[model samples]
Target: MTSDPDTLWRRCAHLGRVLLPLVDQEPGRKADRHENLRTWGIDTVVGERLMEIFAALAAHAVVIDSSVPTAQFDALPVRTVAEAATSKRDFELLAGLPDSFADVRDEQAVQLFRLSAYEGGQASRRLFQLSREVRHSLIVLAEHPLLPCPTCADVLRRATEANLPK
Candidate 1:
């Protein structure tokens, strides 16, 4: 679809910021407690946000790309974390976490820290992959002629009119 590059960039500035900071830098402070907290925040929260953004990207792409019928788009499978999880459990016992530096050294605290860090890394990687996919889909859409079908055009039109992030 033909789009004004300037307008598109403006519309996507928020998501642009996200893609900007995702440069492949050295993972910082490998053992710092605060670093664990940061990773955890990114994994549990930023990860979820990225998934939403990715879905929006896919929706927009599917709406514009005529090669794939819109009917098939709904049936396309999207992988989620739950699908990757091994099992589900309801825990009756929840452990209280450490509050200070010294407490953080305890076995439970260390394990929790490691677990959070691991999960965060996984999420960050997933986010990176999703970003690449969304960007690629948008690029393909931009290079192609706008969908000529009225239904597809209307779907695309409503999406753009909503002023949702690209």
Candidate 2:
């Protein structure tokens, strides 16, 4: 979508919900968790889990009135969301998001996703890359449009309590 600063939040939030989990899991597991288990990119376990979530969202979004986009959604490359142009626009909008309504405009969560896959320039992604479960919990505080609320860190823990594995 061509982002407008006023309505840019929806795009940023949508991207945050969609991409943060993937970016966080781009590396199979965190270095702290398994210092020895250093997989550079997605592995079977992470890939399968992501596919499961993607499939579930695609299949069941219609069941409830949700924003999972059963019909009107982009078929563009995943990298499109991380494009420098869009990311720059989204990044600027975050500061103007109605921060008073923390429930709606969570700047941190959006930035966690937007900066994680920064393109065309060097951006520091240290904070978003959490080293511990507690820190990860902070990122998941806001419920995402595409994914359910209170998400746990894929690097540290998976939500076993959920009905389906994510």
Candidate 3:
């Protein structure tokens, strides 16, 4: 059965909701409560988690609804979602940060919602990578002729709770 753009978008949001908590794990007994993720490549746990989320989205995109062609979606060029990108102001409100939205956006607010696997590059490189994935997927959803279905907007609602400061 072919699913429409709206349904596909909802599925992506659901996938994001499922993987959101993994991005923010509780500390181990000895580890600091607020630990930083190392810059280790996809071999590490952090990297693996990010890849897992992407993989989940890919699998769901093709199988959840037949409207999206696997090859086409996979080939979408990832890039920043400038106009449709999640606003920095929303990030600040959700994270309850004292700093200005611009400060957080400049620092890496995008990375909070989407995890990146790329290794070292220029500053804020990972943010750019995450934005690429987001933008690419959004394009797929917007361009594809999707079918209508019940949505999982609740997943997005729940994700707001996990929003934390960088």
Backbone clash count, each prediction separately: 0, 0, 5
User: TM-scores of the models, in the given order?
Assistant: 0.24, 0.27, 0.28
Off by over 4 Å in 2: 1-11, 23-29, 32-73, 85-166
Compare candidates 2 and 3 on TM-score and give the better one.
3
Q: What is candidate 1's TM-score against the reference?
A: 0.24
Model 1 residue runs over 4 Å out of place are: 1-52, 55-119, 146-155, 158-166
Please give, for residues 1-166, the per-residue lDDT of candidate 2 as tens digits. Answer: 2223333333333333433343344354334323321232434443333322222222122111223332222332222222222223323323333333233324343444345435423222221222122123223322333544322232113322232222
Each prediction's whole-model lDDT (CA)? 0.33, 0.30, 0.33
Q: Candidate 2's error at 12, in angstroms? A: 4.0
lDDT of 2: 0.30
Worst 10 residues of 3 by lDDT: 29-38
**Model number with the top lDDT:** 3
lDDT of candidate 2 at residue 100, scale 0 to 100: 38
- Per-residue CA lDDT of model 1 for 1-166, tens digit only, reads 3133223222222332232122111144223323433654554334434433343333333323334433443332222111211111111011221222222223332344334435665643544454443343333333334443223233344355555434
lDDT, candidate 1, equals 0.33
